[model samples]
Target: DALYVGNALSYRAMAYMDLARMFEFKRTGVAYLDEEAANRGIYGLTVPIVTENTTERESRDNPRAPFYKMYRFIMDDLNLAEACLSDAHAVSAKTDASIGVVYGLKARLWLDMGSRFERYVDDLNTMISHEADEDLNDYDKIGITTANECFARAAEYARKAINEGYSPLSESQWFDPSIGFNTPNNSWLWANIISTNDIAATTGEWQSFVSFQCVEANWGIAVYQDEINYAHGWMIDARLFDKIDEGDWRKTTWIDPEDAGASNAFITKYSRGTNLSYNEWRNYRSYVGIKYHPANGERNTSTIGNAVSIPLMRIEEMFLIEAEATAHTSGVGAGKQLLESFMNTYRMSAGESYTCKAADMEAFTDELFKQKRVEFWGEGIVYWDYRRLELPIERGYPGSNHARQYRFNSYPEHVAPWTNFYIPDRERDLNKGVILNPDPSQAIPLWEGGN
Candidate 1:
């Protein structure tokens, strides 16, 4: 029973973590939506907090939880998980939650919570009255009242996970067609491993084809070669690609124009000997990703290609988190040192060292985030970071690689509110208390700049 309860709590904590990031207000001080949603009074509501203890009647009438309360529940779930779980629990695989995974989530949650500090305080005052369970509702016990405090906890937890002996992958292991991201390595803290019998395998639409360089699959970038079928293939923004230094090992993950030799060789090496013509391969954009190949370097449309492992958490992220949190709690210089150390050790090519050119905190944070974006490309991690930081999305510029229709800038201030998902209509219809987020969906203005 304790084992089941511990696992259930871990899952609940994970789900709540996602919900908090996905639904929390971008900025409580400022409305994320246009004036229309604020006028409609549905601007900043988050998802309803439905805990395991919430009764059916209560669930049907639950109000959207504020940022503080939502996080309170999430922390409580993790706390319960830590208590319920065995210290010696044997975690043979990266898929299962371990003490290190719990620490990783704590680090992530603290950093994310600290990202929207103004909103957290404002929402805390508004929702502080409504209470239920004493143990979970006592926000005072959480001990994080300010962004700096949250950052301290984030660094502390991240350090704990780092002490668990996991290290970042080396250059040779980073894009190894056989073992690179498609399989779990020492760096992975948690992952989702697809097996032959899994639906993702049976359906043959797993991330290996959708986002990875699995040319053997019928879909993804390979769809362009034959011209008979089409599926949306993911690509990197030219602007982001340009930021990657030539010496950085990650530069080879995508089709780099400057490294035409390596790029062409990769296309041929992983092409399953399809021998697509130059024009055929060039039919698609040049910056197509080639990072995630199938397990064991499998090159076919069979289930083997679909049975790829994807990391959900990695030691590399913890290093980033610790660096970021240290910047906030300590000084930018100290954090910059941590970042430079991490990059020099794990990211740079042999004999190359990294240095931070940022003179201040803002520039330093931006530099760190840029490094993270490049490090975790195609990993579905940067979007949440963008949301948390409210960083502008600038997909439109000269020579941009974004699809023509998607080439637009959401910049100079906050990330586009449209990036925040709207509460589902089905949920709204069923629960009277389920307040909705402002529908920020609309055709954005296209950039007039040439691509």
Candidate 2:
């Protein structure tokens, strides 16, 4: 019971921290919003970590607290959970806090805390210590970075988790549209199902917007409507699609207008097959991908749309994280070598090979970042890295159609405006503690280890 409560609280703390990172200015205890840059109707602002009053309203109305206070709240919840949970790897699923899950969550939280990210090295080691197979690289290079003096221990923990039978799917497996949404694979670690008989069960969508993101054409039509509006209009940014090489299996994730039989069109893994009527498929053109479980498909009945599982965390992420950690802590050579090995094993190419190398460490870091963005595009992991690094994204890059209205072009260079959201006026009026972020366009430096 204590473990359960602690885990739940940990989740709440994470959600709060996520919002703060998104909306709050790094140096100031406020969300970024210059009066000249204000936009309305956004809420879900950051909360105070230190509490003087226990009442709901006071907490809601209070201004954003110091970073230390917020970090304390996050740590307290996670620490308590760790104390309550056993290290026996009990309850892999939902019955109780599995030791592995706790460790993984702590590692992620510590990384977010920046100064404490190295703490993950320890938790990862704890998890790795329990592995049945001591050989971290024995099974196709799935978990942890390459073994070396700096990251060997962390690699051990990663190897243990990978030994638990998690890995990335082969390119051919990913290319198969049928059974794409099926679960209990060699790769996926944690997953949750989108049940039918729920709002997310609507034929054209899932609760997480997978249907919206990965589906297009008649395949994505409303479960009830044989033909209707496009589902939610979500898609991969065109510039992101450009990064994939022609020979790479992931290139199938998007389609060029010419190949798609029209301008701005492409094929995606969202379909069960290319067996659809030409007219039916034309509507989708180039706007679909696989992560959204579109292959789970539209149903004849609205009562139950696509029944599919969402991959919450995959070992692939750990692989990438290890590569990055190795690069930063161990050195570029160790990081590069580990990343290259992983790519050669899992992300091999048919026509085009993956390429990223740098003469300088900073340039090498850039290469690593590029690989990460490509590898985890639809998985929803890259944006946080951009925020943490204060990296600028080029929405106006060649082949991009990102709308200008949502972009902040006030400064010398244009900036992505969607990076931060605004706090609704109601938040300021109703909650005395709220302050609107004036400029969501400009990047905020890391609160720690940055000037």
| Candidate 2 local lDDT, residue 32 | 49
| lDDT tens readout by residue for model 2, 364-451 | 7577777677667666677676655556665443344555433322222222345566667777776787667655434433222211
Across residues 100-137, which tens digit of lDDT does each residue of candidate 1 receive? 88888889888886666633576444434444446454
Best by TM-score: 1
Taken over the whole model, the C-alpha lDDT of each candidate is 0.71, 0.51
What is the RMSD of candidate 2?
A: 10.3
CA lDDT for candidate 1: 0.71
Q: Give the poorly placed runs of model 2, Cα more than 4 Å off.
A: 26-46, 50-53, 57-61, 88-97, 115-165, 176-186, 202-211, 216-234, 262-279, 286-291, 350-355, 403-417, 439-451
Name the Cα RMSD for model 1: 3.7
Clashing pairs in 1: none
